[model samples]
Target chain A: GDKVKQSPSALSLQEGTNSALRCNFSIAATTVQWFLQNPRGSLMNLFYLVPGTKENGRLKSAFDSKESYSTLHIRDAQLEDSGTYFCAAEAPGGSAKLIFGEGTKLTVSS
Target chain B: EAAVTQSPRNKVTVTGGNVTLSCRQTNSHNYMYWYRQDTGHGLRLIHYSYGAGNLQIGDVPDGYKATRTTQEDFFLLLELASPSQTSLYFCASSDRDTQYFGPGTRLLVL
Candidate 1:
């Protein structure tokens, strides 16, 4: 039983297309964070949510604690967006440790 | 401009050898974490510390030891490396919110 499950293990998109990645948490998650791991393996934090939604640039993220799920949306994808996207959640009963999903590898082509 | 830097971006060692991965954060964050990324498992926490001289065990603590000597530095030590230990190690710093990650270190145990 995975505490955190991610959808669409992999994705391929056109440069200007849009896509959404999701994560479902079986545990009672209080906080959720999204990250992008580039091809060189550097991880960049995209958003940290405590319920509700947040947007930056062309990316938007939403976390619903009651639903135990989170979503990351990319509008107008770019070549730089081609990477593995991961969502991690911190459970209310856990020891402040984060449980990460298996990640969604995204490939953007021109 | 918070930065979390990991040393020895890449390393190769023989089995039974000892390896030390170093992490330093200039953000003066209170929490520091060590994680390993495998093929299927996106990122698994190995160890973490709230501050200097305070160490906490993570989900996968076996075969790994960690030390937080100062607020700016945290280190992960492997007394006896194995092939299974080969993975991309990431160090992160946080203050109960967004986590800033390092570029990650790729380790190969022969």
Candidate 2:
């Protein structure tokens, strides 16, 4: 069984549209983080949360530790947003190491 | 700004060869981790270190070895490489709740 699972392994969105990504954790996660891996293979951190919500520009993320789930919402998709999105979770009893999901490939077209 | 860099961005080797991937972090973080990413399978932890000279086995450690020579450098070694070991390798460093990733190393075993 996977500790963290991401939904919609792949997604396509038209520019200016809105979309959301979800991550479900089988372990008792204490914290969660979201990242976007660009085509060049560099991963950029999007959000780090602890059972709460955070918003930056057009992206919003929420983590529910009790439910062991997290969500990333994107608004006004742009071409630059086309990349692979990954969600990682940190279990309660473990060191700050993370368990990552397979990732969702997102493509935004005009 | 925190930065983690991986050397030999792309590598190609024949079966049963030896390969080494290097990672360096300028963030002065205490925890470093090595992970591999494969399509349809999320990132799997290969090894990690809490500090210099401290190595710990991760979820997938068979056929792989890791060394933390210094506080800022961590290296992953693949001995007797096989095609199954061909994947994108990423190095990460964490300070508290946020984990920063380096540009991945793409390895191909023929």
Candidate 3:
């Protein structure tokens, strides 16, 4: 079984719409980070959360260490938002490496 | 600008061949990591380093070895390459709690 399980493995939305992605962890994570892998296969950092919430432009993310879960909300989705969204969790005891989920492939259609 | 660079941009090798993927970071971060991305599985860490001359095993380190020769240079080596090792590789450097990723290296094993 995967320590970090992402829900809605694949999602589709229309431009200007909105959607949310979630990650459930069983690793007793201490921190969480979200990234968007664009079409060019480049991973871009979206949010770094430590048991709290953060907002950037139309993207917002929240992480709950105690609950071992995190969420990413995308508003006013654009075509450029179409990519694979990945969530990684940092456990307390390891060498401070990240455990990533399988990821959610998001497709934004115009 | 903060950046992580990897090379070669693309590679192809036969089974039992040797391959080395290189990474460089200009952010002057203390932590560096190597990861591979596949279709279903997003990204899995292969190796990491706290600083120069330090190496740490990641979740999926088998068949892979890594060395951090300098603060800005980290290298991943495949002693005996196999078809299963073909995938996109990414290097990352983390400062504070945020991680910056490289453009990625695409490897094909035959």
Candidate 4:
């Protein structure tokens, strides 16, 4: 079985639009992290959460450990937001390992 | 800014050949990790180290060996490469829950 699963494998949004990406965890995740892999193939860390919500600029993320899920919301999407978004979860205990989802490929066009 | 760098950004090897991927982080973080990303499996952890000379196996550690010679350097070794081992490898350093990633190394085994 898949430990972490992401929905809406691919998405397309118009400039200034908004969309959301979701991740479901089958493992007992203690924390979650979000990242964006840009077109140039560089991974940029977005957020690291421990069961709550955090907003930065036009991006907001929420993680619910009890419910075992996480969501990343993009507001006022721009051309620079076009990339693959990935969510990773760290299981309970002292493990630093992160189980990742396949990712959501996003395209924001003008 | 926390900088994590991986050397030999791209590599090509034949079956039974040897390969090594190197990573260095300047943030002085205590944790470092190695992961492989495939189309369907996303990013699967291969190995991690909490500090110098400490190695911990992840979910997909078979056929891969890692060494952390210092607080800043971590290396992943493939003694006998195979076609199935071809993928994009990432190195990351962490400060608690937040992890910063490297540019990644693309390996191809023929």
TM-score of 4: 0.98
State residue A17's C-alpha deviation in candidate 1, in Å: 1.4
Query: Candidate 4: misplaced stretches above 4 Å?
Result: none
DockQ of 2: 0.79
Candidate lDDT (C-alpha), each: 0.94, 0.92, 0.93, 0.94
Residue-wise C-alpha lDDT for candidate 1, range A2-34, written one tens digit per residue: 899999999999999999999999999999999
Candidate order (DockQ): 1, 4, 3, 2
Candidate 3 runs further than 4 Å off:
none
Q: Which stretch of 10 consecutive residues in model 2 chain B shows the poorest summed lDDT?
A: B94-103
TM-score of each: 0.97, 0.96, 0.97, 0.98
lDDT of 2 at B14: 100
Flag clash pairs in model 1.
none
TM-score of chain A of 3: 0.96
Task: Please give the range of 10 consecutive residues that has the lowest summed lDDT in model 2 chain A.
Answer: A90-99
Worst 10 residues of 1 chain A by lDDT: A90-99
lDDT of 3 at B108: 94
lDDT of 4 at B51: 97
lDDT of 4 at B60: 93
In angstroms, the error of model 3 at A97 is 0.7
Model 2 iRMS: 1.1
